[model samples]
Target: MLYQLNQLRDLSSLFTRKEVKRWLKDDFKSIDIKLERYNLHKKNKGSNYLKFLKETYKILEENYPNEYILKNEFLNKWLKSELGNQNSLIINEFRTGKAIADLAMFNGVSKAFEIKTILDKEYRLSNQISEYKKIFNELYIIIPKIQINKYINYDDCIGIITYDSEVKNFELIKKAVKNEEIDSNTLIEILHTKEYLEIVYKYYGHLPEMSVFTQYEVCKNLLSKIPNQELNSLFLQIIKKRKVNNLFFNKVNNEFNQICLSLNLKDSEKNELIKKLKTNIN
Candidate 1:
């Protein structure tokens, strides 16, 4: 059964980073074998590639839903739920320190969510949570209902949310408390050299002279002197400046919401995907 589920999870390859780039570039032929292998290429009334993808997604959601599907649900549900606001930016695979958060949301503040599915192991979770705590203002661990007992006794600050496959919605089992101890170094690691330099210039009114070789170290030393609270806010501002297609993100079909947001699509790419998805599959 597990093997079958893993096989079904392969359907997600259509949304993989490489494939998404290819799709944006109008390289649809690359996906032909898998579509034909799964018999998803057969002509159907009123079905285009987008509809085909939606149908494929349904099959995975109903059968072998994996981590990406779980993230898709989280993005679709909470992005507009009471939890999210008008300015909310949903980030996928957000890297902080040594851990890559499953999903991170930037609205009024930064929040990180780590998901553990039935197929996942708990070995690295402790380390991941430890890393997340240093940067995010609030943190939550999303898990399957059967695994609740395994994590229910964790630190009080870490919230627990459970997934109900039947209704396909997430329910908050425990509310996460705000963590104020933001690690400046970890937060700085999230930024590119240019972004961190920009932050330094904004806060100090001028950047110190340093060679490209020594600029990173110099900036790190300078940024470390700033208060963690102030730095955390600055980090939020820097990350939020990244381009996420709000127009298409909110307007696209729910089925495409995850990939749309995850891909960090440019305005032209967004238009390209919309047209590409509309192209009929024969």
Candidate 2:
């Protein structure tokens, strides 16, 4: 059962459209099926399960719009029309070597658009903004009205596009980044600031208590920000608390180790880290 839970957690983070399609093809509908069953149950336990599934789906949709469409036919149609092979818009293009802009518009001149479904008032779209300016003549971060106040001035290059029930309207705001834009070093500093880290820590620090699938989701987001060293420390903390059993811990640890190896961590370092972890757990 624990093994299955671990697998479900890993699968939930498979967010790209391609990944979700493959998941559906593989007869892996347990999460959705279980969610439906739970909704039908009258017990509070069932209610909690439904709530968790809804939250998980919400997070997935916000982070991976393309993937979300695989489960909802209406969304697929909407996105296809919005991003069709119109000469005005190019969908899913690799703008910079590092980032993929959700949609790029080349109307007469090069204009880039990064679509973000969820917006936090405090969190700035730093990476998307940097990539857009570096690659295109103009750039906009499209988000909902719920996040308008998060940004001070949206008149410059940083514009906000609000979505109605049916259509989206684009607003041309001022440029968010100036001639002396925030550099990579500065951006990293800001991300690591107490304010930013606090938000991240609040979201991720209590992850061990969450379901295995929930832990995986939180870890996926955390891996984007926290360094490998910090991740290793957190994993150790969870293990020491016996928050997850040995089998589950090993599974997640192996995944993290594989990610580190893919990032070109030296073979010796990889072996050393694995050895240390095994020794500590034993």
Candidate 3:
């Protein structure tokens, strides 16, 4: 049973459009195999597919340590509770410089979160935090309660958020100080070409006049001339403009918020997913 549940530990399959379609079409062959092996078929009898998924997730949370569980919990506590009504954008696996942030939240300011599960090693943690510090206004590392001591002597500028499975909640063990020394070059590198171009146009009052091949370098040079503080504000403003409709926040279950929001699903796909969650499975 443990092995079977471990196989589904990622819980990524439940978020994909292809998998959602297959399940909605009543194609349970693959799922049935795993459930049967885990001896959950009889225990999950008559529940809708969504209910079964929730139950499976609950079981997994109690039995295993995984990053997705941490992501979902953070989304619930930070995204929903703190910035629920704010004009914020939560990005998963956000790339900046040599590191990819586990989660990045943008509102009027930028915040990066690096998740460290008990199952993970701290081999590249320093590198990841160094990269994030260059681009984000605030930084946080989310870790399991048991691993708190490992980060006890870490920098106080970076916050520590701990997930205690006992209460299924995230606590801010340390408050992060806002990073005032953002690297303009690193920040600009992470922006989409169009976003940086817009920023250039915003500050310079005109877009750079360069060939397509040279536009990147030309714009980068122009953006680099702006004061760091102003450039950072512009970056946040442009990112927050990449909006997710409120329908997603209102319709999807909070547990699925991180994946669903990051998926950038079409309106039709979101509607289909919302409808399918209520679907019954024998």
Candidate 4:
């Protein structure tokens, strides 16, 4: 059973670092900031955080014994299976972290497994890879399929796994795994495209309902951290068509006032820009 468990772990590690890098680049921003902040805090806190993680790992090892898997896998499989199966799995075994390794089985052989989610620089899989190697010859890092190439020496690993809901081509994932280098930036862009598109879609028809205030606030906060021109362009494009409601009008007005006060912009220049925007809207 331990050997079988190790096999599953090896197969799962086929997800290369390059692939994980790509996924994080694209989708990292889409993750709830509060959760990210908490993870970051945990990572920075050192041994206490490691202890918590180790406890979680210990729980999985204790409960499943032979069928250990990650939370994301359980969620993915549960979503894809029949509704009844989903309910049964969730109610009876999912929460307990024990499920028969149906997917990890081939013929009569079963493999060991390890699952991971939300890869970041601080709590990255790289840190855990060695430990996983010690326990199982095979290790898997389940991530979005779009990032499969990010994994280094994937061909040498057992296999790359992803959620069924992912739209990436399996062949592409296999091919990427063979490559030597993976561009994390490109991967992140791909992962977050859906999130950006969703925000755009929500405000498409109801521009007036668009939360310009929040947009501006986020932009202002992020401006120091991001390229100024790119940030400005993104902000302008998203809020360009949005009608100035009370919140929108007040936010913009406040921003304009703050900018005027902080910079060399005269009241006349500020008013000119406002007039131009109003004219364009009318």
Leading candidate by lDDT: 1
Candidate 3 off by > 4 Å: 1-27, 83-85, 245-252, 266-268
lDDT per residue (tens digit) for residues 14-128 in model 2: 3333432333344334444543443423333323432443345444333433322222322123323443233342324434545665554333344455655542342346765
Consecutive 10-residue window with the lowest summed lDDT within model 2: 241-250
Better of 1 and 3 by lDDT: 1
Cα deviation at 196, candidate 3, in Å, is 0.9
- Model 2 earns a TM-score of 0.37
Question: Per-residue alpha-carbon lDDT of model 1 for 1-282, expressed as tens digits?
Answer: 233655586777776677777777777775666767755566543477777777777877877667878878777775467477778877778898889998888887788999998889989988998999988998999998878999998778898989877788888999899987877677668888888998899889999999999988888888889887778778788888887664324545666666766777666766778788777666
Off by over 4 Å in 2: 1-19, 23-26, 31-33, 36-85, 93-97, 117-124, 152-155, 164-282
lDDT against true structure, model 2: 0.40
Please provide, for model 3 over 1-282, each residue's C-alpha lDDT reduced to its tens digit, 9 standing for 90 to 100: 455554665443554446655765667666666667667788777776677777666766776647777787677666556643567777778898999998888887788989998889998988998999899989989888888999966777898988888888788888788987777688678888889889999999997569889988888788778988888888888888775643335534655555565666556766676577666656
lDDT of 4 at 59: 39
At residue 275, candidate 4 shows an lDDT of 46
User: After superposition on all CA atoms, what RMSD does each candidate show versus the true structure?
Assistant: 2.8, 19.4, 2.8, 25.1
List clash counts for every candidate, in order: 0, 8, 0, 26
- For model 4, residues 1-282, the per-residue Cα lDDT tens digits are 132444334333322233223333433221123225334344433333223333333433333322223333333333224112211211111010122222221111112233433232324444454333322223344544434556535436544555332332112122111112222222123223333433344434222243644643332233334443343334334332332211111233432222232232445555554443232110
Error of 2 at 30 (Å): 3.4
User: After superposition on all CA atoms, how large is the RMSD of candidate 4?
Assistant: 25.1
Arrange candidates by lDDT, highest first: which order? 1, 3, 2, 4
